[model samples]
Target: MPQEFSRTERVADYLQQELAKLLLHSVRDPRAEFVNITAVDVSRDLRYAKVYYTKLGVESAEAATDVTRVLDKAAGFLRTEVAKGSSLRTVPKLTFKFDESVGRGRHMEDLLGRARASDALRGNEAEADDS
Candidate 1:
């Protein structure tokens, strides 16, 4: 029988959970205080992992860049911390990326709200025309 989850997927899940905890309670940088680990993608060879994160209440480009910089600067420390909790032979290189999907989702919601309002107005106009 085929395995339920591939090794890479399992590793990604482990990294995601552990990283979330470490970022929340271990990392002391103020800039990383509100960082949320959105997802973790591990390569097939497990040589590198892309860590996606987004800062709570921070959507500006500069703020995103700042968080990314801080995380990247602390990558080595984070890797070591992860190593302490894992049985993997080698910890994958960490790369921090600011996840923009949250911001994009917000923007999409705003657009959808406007569209709904526009449709409502048109509906009212049509009702008035029928009267």
Candidate 2:
């Protein structure tokens, strides 16, 4: 007997393929602005998937809701698209989710820059004290 494929892996692959198509062809979301699918996580049973996406252009909290609503509405279409794209027997449901990792990483970089500036200032002060 062939080993069964895990639900999580199946769901991840489905989401990546379907969302890419929707972004390229089907979706007509007004709030769309260079959205990138960063990652995806699927539950054990393949019922729901948490999609991680980031916006490259201007992004706002209100825009996020519109994007999500469009994605939710297009889930069925996405499922069909995924089925067509993959060789799997089943495709898990798609769920659009905002991934904050991109934002968090940006925030951390800002903090690091500040810390570096502060360290440089202190080093200058130490040099002045020695003089």
Candidate 3:
């Protein structure tokens, strides 16, 4: 019978939890202070993992770049910490990536708000004309 969760999936989930704790308490860089781990994707061989992260109150490209730089520089240390905390024989290399989904969602919300406001205005104007 096949396992309910593959080794890679298990590793990815473990890494995500450990990394979140590490980022929250271990990392001290100001750029990474607000970093939130959005998702973790581990390779089937468990040799590499891509960590998606986002920063609070960092919307500009320059700010995002700075956060990414800090996280990437600290990847080695993070990986070492993960190795010490987990029972895995090999800890996957960490790659830091800025996740833009949050920002995209905010933008979508703004667009939706504008659309709704416009529709309401049109409805109001139509009612005024009908009266």
TM values, all candidates: 0.95, 0.80, 0.93
Better of 1 and 2 by TM-score: 1
| Predicted structure 2: lDDT | 0.74
Model 2: residue 88 alpha-carbon error in angstroms:
2.4
C-alpha lDDT (0 to 100) for residue 24 of candidate 3: 93
Per-residue alpha-carbon lDDT of candidate 3 for residues 1-131, written as tens digits (9 for 90 to 100): 98999888888888889999999999998768878888999988889899988889975555688888888899999999988887889999999888888888999999999999999999999999999
On residues 1-131, what C-alpha lDDT tens digit does candidate 1 reach at each position? 99999999999999999999998888999988988888999999999999998888987666689788899999999999999989999899999898888998999999999999999999999999999
CA deviation > 4 Å runs, candidate 2: 1-7, 58-63
- Top-down lDDT ranking: 1, 3, 2
Which candidate tops TM-score? 1
Candidate 3 lDDT score relative to the true structure: 0.88
Candidate 3: RMSD to truth: 1.4
- At residue 7, give the lDDT of candidate 1: 94
Off by over 4 Å in 1: 60-62
Q: Flag clash pairs in model 3.
A: none
